[model samples]
Target: MMLPKAAKDPSCGAPKHTGLLREELLVFRHLLGLGENPSQIRLGPPLSNSSLKDILFVSIDVDGPRDFKCAENSPCLVGISILDTRRLQFYMTTISVAAKTRSALGNVENLIKSHQLQVGQSNHLSYRSSKFLFGETRQIKADKVKTYLQRLIKDRFFVLVTYGGGAADCIYLEGLRLGIRPLYHLDVLKVAQFPLQTYYRYSLAKILDALKLPWQDLHIAGNDARFTLHALLMTAVRDWNYRDDKPKSKPTPSTQVTLSSIKTIAKAWRIPDQDQPSLSFLFEDHIIKERVLLNPETRKNGKRLRPEKTPEEKAQRRERKKLAKEKRKLKEARRPQWLFNLGDLLDNE
Candidate 1:
């Protein structure tokens, strides 16, 4: 779906068009790894009829392909995205109540710190600063931070990590999907072989230390995404190491386990299950679809979709066209008159 680009360079000026918020774009780019030069990064066209109204929050799933081990029972991720489209530049951070486990909290702290660094370095100035300088608005409120976070979680942008057993099961599922069989006996290694607790603590502590800064300290989405990715990678790396010694039936490439790779897998797995429908699907799926189809009929019925032109409106349009015609005529008339004048009229008289 087409998504709006974020404002990376304040020098370009605030977007005058209404739609996606600058902050949402920032978060999307961070998730997609597009970063500051998002304009150069082509995205699929904006989802048709999609406006800021449809957007509740944006999310990036950082954990491995499988849903969190206890994802059904507990929240496994945090939701950090924009809350309102009217103020597209602002961000709201949210964490799932189920994700409030000690390990999840650590990830959140790391994510906050990493984001702070990105904002600090990105050339795009903070929204408040831009508003103060260009829009002449007041400073941003401190409370918005918590509010934004809550909105993000409500929007499903964050994820919940499952229990240790679930995580291992997911890994096995990945192996099964790849068509690899165990090379050695399963009895040699324990399923709960990873040191998830240690990784979670280290990653969280690193992030919390970064978030100690003041609100004004964080500005860009790319930075936040980077830090979150860092934490994700740290967790993944540690988990991989923990599983390294285990004799698996089959092993997939490391790249296959990344966020992007998992999305591919998910899509492939989901494609066959999708219900098939016809053109009518457009009417049901899109708000504008029905309107666009009815527009011609409405016009035929003399119920103009747009406001009917008043006599004054018709007169103004006529006057405009007439003036344009007159201007052209005047130019042509001048040329002929000039030629006539250039003739020896005065001498002949």
Candidate 2:
């Protein structure tokens, strides 16, 4: 199918096809089997501190970058997920693109082929997981992705929770600008990384590991989205539970947030929000709290807490100061003791 073509948007890069994941559909069917209504429901606010039932997590994963000005990029695969904020594995609904053939799906065969050495040239994994992993590619693909995403975008779901409102946020907003109406604006969250980077750093595999879910046919957008959702949920849970259960008038959670993505650490990055309308909630307070133990800084209440120093550190400082003072006193007493005694005795006399 001829890929949908749009103007080149420097901000968004080139568009890519969103993969249609059939596994998600099967899961959706399983969800239906449970007799839960599949109707689109507006998500409630994502409670960073609330229980899993109180919060809902939604996320979108686009495989390729697109231009903000135009949709000239080939639409590859975009994966989306709705899940419990507390339990990432409990997926409410996962919607992804499905094509008629695996080849038609942008993120499926092509990705595995690119990693021939890693995944195998004969496509053992790809062949084995073909039927179970991806949905058949669509025969007649749409030219523009805006129309497709318009149907997928839900109200009240937070955006840019993955990349910290970086380029992903830009592409989403640009899609909103040119796509159909019902552009629901919600708060954007910027979660910090964990103190121990390796322990807290998450991926689709890591998320699956945490959930104890089987990790197979991974890397597809839909799978990625699900994993990303769970990963974020795990991070949020860690952040929430790290603090005391008791409600304090003054709370600090940033000390617990330690999530870091490629863009979040960029030294020079100012995200663009051209047509991003106010979704009623300005997220100035939505920033994740991070515990900065080493550097003493002004707190929200204007009181500056001293840098958190360990007992050993304080003791070392005290020892150093005491030794320096003793050294100076000894130097003074060395040669000056006689002269100092002479002056004192003369004055007394």
Candidate 3:
């Protein structure tokens, strides 16, 4: 009897490899300084000083002559990761079909042949990890990708362009600093989908388009990242314009008064006799204090105290105070009280 067919190893190693590849892609993209997709972009408050150090850019590119690869496809996928706000790291992987069928391998071979690039042929997959200071033209395609990625890191905006046939679907991700946390995500999506237009919008686009070179050549991973960055910048400038135009009431005269004038008025209004008196009395005592200060003996104390108001004024004040006190007392007396003992006491009475 066939010894219990050795239990099929449940661990079909393909998943593990795929998982690792996905992680590698994330890291690779991050290192390359690629902007996150519109959905992935995290818009936070002006990053706190503490968090500024951790800010970074990650980008992943899956490039083949075609977008999708079948099980038997041997198309190469180039993944890059760039780290801004710190050092950088770049990684590249070339995957080939593992199938044994002649038909499958034949299809892979034909696809590779169609592209006119060899199965193991390498493109500019290498990259520099130093802080990108300044550059005009990059020597390698990867370097050019890195330059665009840096812009995404600094601007906190991204435009994702999905190229299909001859046309492209443009998506812009714009980061915004809102006081609320949850709104940040919602706002970015809203802005990306429907951007506000302004004269500066064109300027932003021009600057971004000029900076993104490889993006213009290959509608691949790097290019998608560059577009995302452009969209973000455009969105940011537009947002700023919107905020500047937001309606606000003109300042009142009292509010707009200069600090120096306020200080002078405060000094002039001080009561010479009263020390830290009520604000109402402070105004009334100002002239009295100035008159007292002119006399010699009053000048000895260098302070003149304002006398209590006339009997009529005081009587009026007392009447107002009594009315206010009675109103407060009446309010307090009328307040409902839920007392457990009230029913029992009333029954006994």
Best candidate per TM-score, number? 2
Q: Please, what are the lDDT tens digits per residue for candidate 3 over residues 19-88?
A: 1112222222232222232335443332322222233333333444442322113333333223332221
RMSD after CA superposition, every candidate: 23.2, 22.7, 28.8
TM-score result, candidate 2: 0.34
Alpha-carbon local distance difference test for all models:
0.30, 0.36, 0.30
Off by over 4 Å in 3: 1-54, 65-73, 77-191, 196-215, 243-349
**Candidate No. with top lDDT:** 2
| Candidate 1 residue-wise lDDT at 69 | 37
Q: Which stretches of candidate 1 lie over 4 Å from their true place?
A: 1-139, 160-228, 244-247, 252-349
State residue 335's C-alpha deviation in candidate 1, in Å: 99
Off by over 4 Å in 2: 1-56, 65-75, 84-144, 154-160, 163-169, 172-192, 195-214, 244-349
- The TM-score-based order of candidates, best leading, equals 2, 3, 1
Deviation of model 1 at 73, angstroms: 34
RMSD of 2: 22.7
